[model samples]
Target chain A: MNMTFFQKFFLFFSLAIVCAGCGTDETMESQSSLDINPLSAKPSLFDQSPSNMAKESLMEYEEITGIKAVNSDKEMIIAVQIKHMKRFFMAKHRKAWQKEMEKQFPGWKVELSTDRKIYLELDKLEEKINKDTLSKDELKKEMKHIIKLSKEQT
Target chain B: MIFFWAFVVGGIICVIGQLMFDVFKLSPAHTLTILVVFGAILDGLGLYEPLIDFAGAGATVPITSFGNALVHGALQEADKHGIIGVVTGMFEVTSAGISAAIIFGVIGSLLFKPKG
Candidate 1:
């Protein structure tokens, strides 16, 4: 297209701003598997009697695309994938699901997040659990690490 | 993924604007007004939110976001305080962008000479 030098400069400047705002840690090449089975067969990490209530409650939320959860003795941590558009209201959804999960699984401190990074990490942990690769102690350590990461503020 | 989507969507929007200016011979002012109105209409139809979700700041940084923000702000405030909120809330989310544009336009006019 024929354009003045100023026009070209303006177009590039705007595109640069758009790209800068879109930067994230995620790669376009990788697909997240965490959403495939949000509640994988209760791995050894969850020694308690299994409950479908958590899965059923999670499924009720129309915006959720995927889920991964693991629990230690007193704490249950969950990472969820939300439909991109609905993410604008993440705080509301996070609060709603947190409340629902708490009600479903009483006597446990529940932690819920929609962060993609957390979902990826949990997916890896779940993979290890399925393969019988992670020890109970290592599993606890990993859970603690993931939980800390979730609490981190950017 | 967000980066890719944002670039693609923002690029397409910019392309459409460029086409309007070059092919239709529309003034910059007219093109911008039309885009903003289009955004507002989309917001009214509940379609802009999904676009924002898909494109992130790509959708937000464009001029169309001005329209979306105007309507969104008005609706939110109207829900809380009724009709008067429409006037007050219209500029709530868009104030920074609008104020910056005016201030910069003044400074630019003072600093630069027109080409034609």
Candidate 2:
């Protein structure tokens, strides 16, 4: 009573699939068991921590191209500095990074700068914003100026 | 446990991509497109949501999820606006990603000099 090789193979394959389907080890926590809808399950960027945002922005910079984000500082604007990759000299590469930054942080200025002059201003502005010395209107005025400057160079 | 499944599932997906690139000799672009289209088709059939729930980022991080997001957006819109939803829905949910890619891609082309 010899079985054909194909029949034997099919039998083993079916059994393997059945075994895989029947496993019941649910190792994940019950956090998933909570009643979470798909709509609400989507990730949101609003009201997130600033430091984490900085970290992720740097990560995104590195991911987009091979270039590292040399620096990141979040103030009125989210300033992310990319290393002076030769690619940055490419017009398309700079635009791509610029668009990439804006996409991540909409309505918030994410200036992608390689210029030393603008990079210095970005850090100084962040320092002022952190100090909280300026009044609300004054802060608003400073932000406008910073935006203008960022646009002018980068 | 969640992380474990996420790792396993994500690893499997990546392995498939690697195999296609290495063994099958498929280009990276073709592999990515195929995965995305496959995801979209699965989403249309209502099969992908369960996999997403089970694998989380394992499922979502892959290029396939881009197609899933596109189909998901369309399906959601179809419920609201009838046939017109078919067209508008494609971009509604995934515009953030698609727009960024397109805008950034164009900018990169314009700003940088390709290696000569």
Candidate 3:
């Protein structure tokens, strides 16, 4: 049927609202009987000693810079504050590094922020360094080098 | 097509907002404040989460999302700091989004002269 722009707009809007409202009900109903377990029950591979060591290194770096470091199995996020710089500086630096990373790795991302935070995806590191193929000592040395560089940057 | 629907939903919301402004003879700023407060109330009642799930970006890319952000931030802060949360919670959660909006809005306003 032919309709004015406003009429069409209102029709679509009302439909969307109704659909959204109905979808919630559907989700609740579907989830009610489902035996879904939270992922917390199973400890991740990164919960092991090497990952702990990596996290410790990040923590040490943060302690020195008066910043904070958050390490997860997948990524490491570091935050710090520097004097006499605008807040946007962090964003700019992050953007620059991200661009550089994109150029080097094509699809991989390394996020840096003006907040004195840097994030490196562990999966990307594993892929780049062939961590699975490396010997244990080689892996340790590589991780140490990475930790050193991360600390030096801040 | 998903992005298209998102824009359409956002545009429709804006239209309704404009209509409300005209019919009630309300200032845009006042309308915005009221809408945000209404969104906060809905979020407090735990109704907004469903809307977010359904509408995806449609619900999130609106000014109402800002209200949701405020409510969520406030609640999280309250959880952490108790009564002092009233002052700190909203700012902590929503500061990044709000600050960015303000900075961009200011930049846009300065760069583009709007005819009254």
Candidate 4:
């Protein structure tokens, strides 16, 4: 029952692939120090806000580095930057967060995404809102645009 | 770090191919065919997408990913249009790669002659 070198090597490689499939990815450490504070702890954008609650809840997860959220009367949109490695399981994380958020705020539509483009758009929206540069109608239109972008397949 | 992982994963894949050729006395064609089929199987099992997510271009750059793409396109279209979709969608994602291979193969043949 002597195995050739090729057979031995093949067996080892198969074991390795199986072990790799079994292993779960660990969440990576924060890369940058930007906005290390929780969004709820940040300077008040609005009091008793559902958007703030959404951001705060998102920040509790270590993989979420930065979060931007804005809500209309019926819809709450959230964008988060996940740690690079954890992005491998991003679909899973997003689904879990979506369920939790929907549960927390019943009757409110919770839209969560980890797309880089969405994050950048939300960041711009946050800046405009902070500066009070956007009118109510303008904010509503922008949110609608972002939601449309999220729904895009490509 | 991302680059590092990409190199490591891509290199490992190449190494495995090399081993199959050198140790098992497999021809290059046989080795490549086996790898591509292996990739398609992985994709069928819903495993290759996670690998691509984890390794980025490291996973996508290999020949294995070509098979994964072919199966993925077929499966996606099959869900929408049934049996006909499998044939129609087989090349949706892989048409670019196949076209490039043909064009490059012509260029390569024009540039060099095989002695054997």
Candidate 5:
């Protein structure tokens, strides 16, 4: 159909408004997941060593879900995979939380791999915390405990 | 149908420009420049605020939006520093985008061996 310029402008303008409006509900629904404060909440340090602190943080994360953290010094990587329903949302929160952890630890560098892997340096660990490497299960358990500690802090 | 609507909206904007040129006997270059300046001025006056409120991406994802950004930046700078506004203005507004473009362009040029 032949439409006048004004008609066409209004039609497209209205359509844009409708499309934006439709997404508003979904955006509102997603707002809770986007809450920055929860992720911003400070994580208490139970382990002094950078490796142990990273391990402890990962263990806490695992406790919340059944995920496992794998640390690799050679590659400078630590990562966890979880099948949580809110995986994407939780991952975003975890990233923010990791940033807070980095700030808390200071002097130690932390890097998160693109594939949701977290890596930490062993030398940066506090002298008091044990430097011994954790097995997969031990890491998982420790991560759970860390999550519990984090929740209690909240 | 969507493409039709896109064409229609784009055509309307062009048609308005054409009408302004024909009625006022404005040269094509002058008309184009005037349209850009007018858009910038309206954006500066905050008249584009309602348009942005109504059509978020529609108002923003256009060349006119750049004009709006420039005007907005100029105004913001004017607020801080009275007369030397224009010089400091564009940097405050478009710095991030300009920096990214420059950095990426340099990196892309260096890395990519483009075919003639």
Candidate 6:
């Protein structure tokens, strides 16, 4: 019944390993499923896009500034964030991205910011979406508002 | 073929984990969180998918695989809910494992006692 720290640790570690392996068998299936090409429905190692343009734009942004975009939705929202220090330089690209998105969304816009709080709201908003309390358009609007607030947060 | 690769890959990932626990002095909780977070980052970057493809279960069964599941869930949510999917997708991937852990862990604590 008596145990040392290592004994407790060993017991817990073994349990973790055993439990880790014991979970549902979907991990491999899930990963392999991504191997399916949207273009072909057949398996493929190439063409995971609709992200191609976003990737290109982000590359251009990084190439000139030597800073990478930390993240981007790039499609629905064109939501993106640069490193905190680099956010000051985001104005031109933000404007450009907004102009580009206008073709599809008209009054819709894009933004660039380094705000940390929007992420917290994003978490809550995500929950609301899951619960079905918010309409789809409302979620989109909330996201855009958050992204804009992120850009304006300085 | 898949099972062999799964064992090898899964073993190597677990070995790295064990080493971190032994040599680097990372607690099991912190190590587990780190692995999952690291995997999620890789998944977000579009890198982990290929690694998963190569390693199969070797890549997918470990803690990092949980991170991939998080990304997968989030991506699916994004499709359904728009931008917030990025936030909402956190735990859906590993929900099953988590549920099992909680249930079994509580039972073990009730039945087993550690003497100090």
Docking class of 2: incorrect
The predicted structure with the larger TM-score, 4 or 5, is 4
**Scoring each candidate complex against the real one, what DockQ results?**
0.13, 0.05, 0.03, 0.19, 0.05, 0.03
DockQ of 1: 0.13
Residues B74-114, model 6: lDDT tens digits = 88788889989868966766688789999999999999998
Docking class of 5: incorrect
Fill in the DockQ of model 6: 0.03
Answer with 5 or 6, whichever has the higher lDDT.
Answer: 6
Top candidate (TM-score): 4
Candidate 6's residue-wise lDDT over A88-118, tens digit each? Answer: 3445555675565455334423343323365
Candidates 1 and 6: which is better by DockQ?
A: 1
TM-scores for all candidates: the values are 0.55, 0.41, 0.42, 0.70, 0.34, 0.40
B32-67 per-residue lDDT for model 5 (tens digits): 777668778878777664444334444554445656
What's model 1's lDDT at B22? Answer: 100
Whole-model alpha-carbon lDDT for candidate 1: 0.77
The DockQ assigned to candidate 2 is 0.05
In order, what lDDT does every prediction score? 0.77, 0.58, 0.52, 0.78, 0.49, 0.56
Position A63, candidate 1: lDDT? 76
After superposition, candidate 5 runs with Cα above 4 Å error? A1-154, B1-35, B113-116
- Residue-level lDDT tens digits of model 4 in A62-136: 787788888767788888877767867887888899898999889988889977789889888877676667666
Among these predictions, the greatest lDDT belongs to 4
In order, the B-chain TM-scores come to 0.86, 0.83, 0.75, 0.88, 0.60, 0.78
